[model samples]
Target: MKVQLLVSKWCPVCPQAERIWTEAAQKVPMDLEVLDVAERNGREVVSRLRIKTVPAVVVDGTLKTVGVQPLGEVLKLLGA
Candidate 1:
């Protein structure tokens, strides 16, 4: 599975989101990419998905959820 995490450096909760997903990725067999909203790739995703919040999770090109999800929830999302 392809997992894309949309985040920003200034977002306080983004780091937490990153940590959860990063740890999940290490345990699961999936592709994980962290994208900054200010970057071109992240902007494309935000525009396409109409995402209005930071710490968004895109699983296989589909917007799964937003905000800092719990580690268990993130693992579940990854189907781990």
Candidate 2:
């Protein structure tokens, strides 16, 4: 699965989002990409997805969650 974790530099929720995804990567079979919304590609992806918030998770090109989610929920989303 393709998982994109979209975050912003100034977003307070980003760090935990990063940590959760990073740890989850070890337990799931997925292509995880962490994007900083301050960058070009990140901005493009976020705009294309119509996501207005940070700490967003995109799984298989579909927006999954827009904020910090429990690890169990994330795993379920990943189909792990």
Candidate 3:
């Protein structure tokens, strides 16, 4: 599965989200892309998904959840 983490450098909680997802990626067999909203690819995702917040999680091209998810929750989301 594909996991896209939509984040912004300015968002306070984004770093934590990134950490969780990065660790989760190491444990799962999925493609994990960390996208910054200020960048081109991230902007496209944000626009396409109508996402208005940072630390958003997208699984297999669908918006799964928003904000900073715990490690266990993230693993569950990834079906790990």
Segments of candidate 3 deviating more than 4 angstroms: none
Across 1-80, the per-residue lDDT of candidate 1 in tens digits comes to 99999999999999989998889988898899999999999999999999999999998989999999888988887777
As for candidate 2, its clashing pairs are none
Q: Candidate 1: where are CA atoms >4 Å away?
A: none
Between candidates 2 and 3, the one scoring higher on TM-score is 3
TM-score (C-alpha) between model 3 and the true structure: 0.96
Report residue 35 deviation for candidate 1 (angstroms): 0.3
Q: Each candidate: what lDDT?
A: 0.92, 0.91, 0.92
Among residues 3 or more apart in sequence or in different chains, the pairs in candidate 1 whose N, CA or C atoms overlap within 3 Å are: none
- Scored by lDDT, model 3 comes in at 0.92
TM-scores for every candidate against the unseen true structure: 0.95, 0.94, 0.96
Worst 10 residues of 2 by lDDT: 71-80
| Model 2 ranges with Cα > 4 A deviation | none
